[model samples]
Target: MKKNLKRIAIVAMVALVIAACKKNQESAETAPQETVKNADKVLQYIKDLGFPASSIVDNGNEFVVEEDILFPKDMQIPAGGAGTKIEQYYTGSIVSATKKLNIRIFVDPSMTSMSSEINSAIAQWNGVPNSTLRFSIVTTAPYDILIKNEALAAPPGFVTCGQAQFPSGGSAGALVRINKTAIASNSFAQRARTICHEFGHCISFRHTNWAAQGESTATNVPGVTGTDALSLMNGGQCNSGATVLSQKDKDATAALY
Candidate 1:
């Protein structure tokens, strides 16, 4: 009788521990779905966009791609694509409406502490010569883009840094997420460059060195094709790359805009 009771107690304890582990997992996996309507739709959307399903990360508010681009669950899925070097540009599907000159960025309270770095980023884009494109910070709503701080999952010693949404239709994508704490130890210039790099994504620029980076492919800007050693649009250089737009970077924006 004593042996039987001990075995039953051991089994009960095991079951209780297993049940607790499962409960914790469910809570961790449950992110607010917003208007995703059908869970399968997001998976299909990723496939239709030519992204591998394995590249998808189930971030709470949006889907992160290439560790830097963001796709909100509620965003309208783009209808077509831009073709090319398989590395530089996103063609028409990702650019802001050509006529929309100024992009308003509203920083989240969580990100406001880095105002100086954010301002430097805005100045770099606004200073792009001959391009009507401009970025301004606003404290109130009626804003076109929101910059927020978000913690991303990554392996130890590796950080996702920042993520931006590609413009769909003619408007600039609505958000940029900075891993504020991850890059806090970087110099001020590096911090600003991190912001600068993400904003590049908002306007449809791809890693200028994508081919070298092993990105599947990218289309170069017309009349401005090929690699730019000084390109600010290059990815994977966070906290240690070009701090300003290179001359070609300016020219590309001039040509595109």
Candidate 2:
């Protein structure tokens, strides 16, 4: 009788935990969307910026423009198509750098366990020749970037390897999501590369292969025009992408930062 009672207690506890998780998820889904003045006009504003209609996904609170940009539903549309609030002033253009050279990257509790991969990604950007841009891990308030792990399921449907929030207000975007579980089994180099790719986005890099990816247009770095087969900033390559920045990649970084 005691054994049976203990078994019942364990099952009850498990059910309670599952119920809590379901409630949390439900709250997230029902959270209020961003407050936009006009949904249709805001959408038109996005289209005016060169994003095709198909690339835009109405995600309730915001529009997922392209595979990376998150356009909040409540943002004030600029009088001109180009808005000061945008991370990148122009598509295919390098993102503007922060006022300070040492950019602070904070790993959330969920991502701290992957320190080796995080540091590896940081080293690549910090070692860029002739560039003042640098990335540092912080453990306190006022961080420039937050890298966090996200649980992503795959099987019957496809999900992106990771997502990055672009810099805004002249600083690095505050968030970078890493699908740790999905790529946790990748080689050390590949794991680092996945992170490296997302960091590149945080700084305003358009995929080098955007043209081939059906983006209507992508601007070339002033002097470094043309496709780079080994560019580390190529999107959709994920674990198979270039593990290090190519010569053109370095040139582009030097040109911009």
Candidate 3:
């Protein structure tokens, strides 16, 4: 009887855990979608600055507004699109030219020492063809830089972490200026991945939605595919490190330039 009781207790505990997870998922789904909607607006505003629409890739979750942006219209919706058609922005342009990109990295004073790690990560990113980007790390308090510099206001809409600029001409360049909050929230590994991911955005790669290319069937997300799961481009806590580039990431880079 004791053994049977223990078995019942185990099953009950399992059920409780599943219930908790479901509730958490449900709660996430129910949070106000307003933040996401705002992020879409900011992205469109950035695109207006001369970047191709495909440049803003969404992380595959609700916390990131990019996941919900509607294509053509350039709008952000609820996560999973709430069963509505997923939206994406696409401007077909191969952004490759000699000296085509100039990237400036700004680190808060606390994050200043991370420069070497940042440089190492950027080097790997540069090794990827069609990247055509350059970077210089600057040490300063990021929040002060944004608040004090009229030129660098808060990112439009609601992207609270960081910002970038892609200017035109043969001098096409992208700048990634980060905030202290970003540094605090991200790990060393995460920082490296974030740099590459942002650079991926700088080079015009969109999220891994099967709908964008009109493929009727949904495929695995590029970097999240199977066990290989190596691509700086992949979302979530899992896709960090040298082994993260999926075949699709390679293809996307090749396609970009």
Q: Model-by-model lDDT, in order?
A: 0.78, 0.72, 0.42
For each candidate, give its TM-score against the true structure: 0.78, 0.74, 0.42
The most accurate candidate by TM-score is: 1
Off by over 4 Å in 2: 1-34, 38-45, 73-100, 152-157
lDDT tens readout by residue for model 2, 1-257: 99999999999999998898787775754333334445666688767656789898887766766565555565545445444322211233233455438788889999988899999999998888978888899899788888899864333555567777555445665578888877878899888988988888777676788777776455666677788879888877767889998888887777668
Lowest summed lDDT window (length 10), candidate 2: 85-94
Error of 3 at 71 (Å): 16
| 1-104 per-residue lDDT for model 3 (tens digits) | 99999999999999998898787775765443555666665455444423345545554321122332222222332232222111121222224455435444
Candidate 3 achieves a global lDDT of: 0.42
* Pairs with steric clashes in candidate 3: 70-87, 71-87, 71-88, 230-243, 230-244, 230-245, 231-244, 231-245
Report the C-alpha lDDT of model 1 over 123-192, residue by residue, as the tens digit.
9988988888888888898887899999967767878899898776677878898999889999999999
Indicate which candidate wins on lDDT: 1
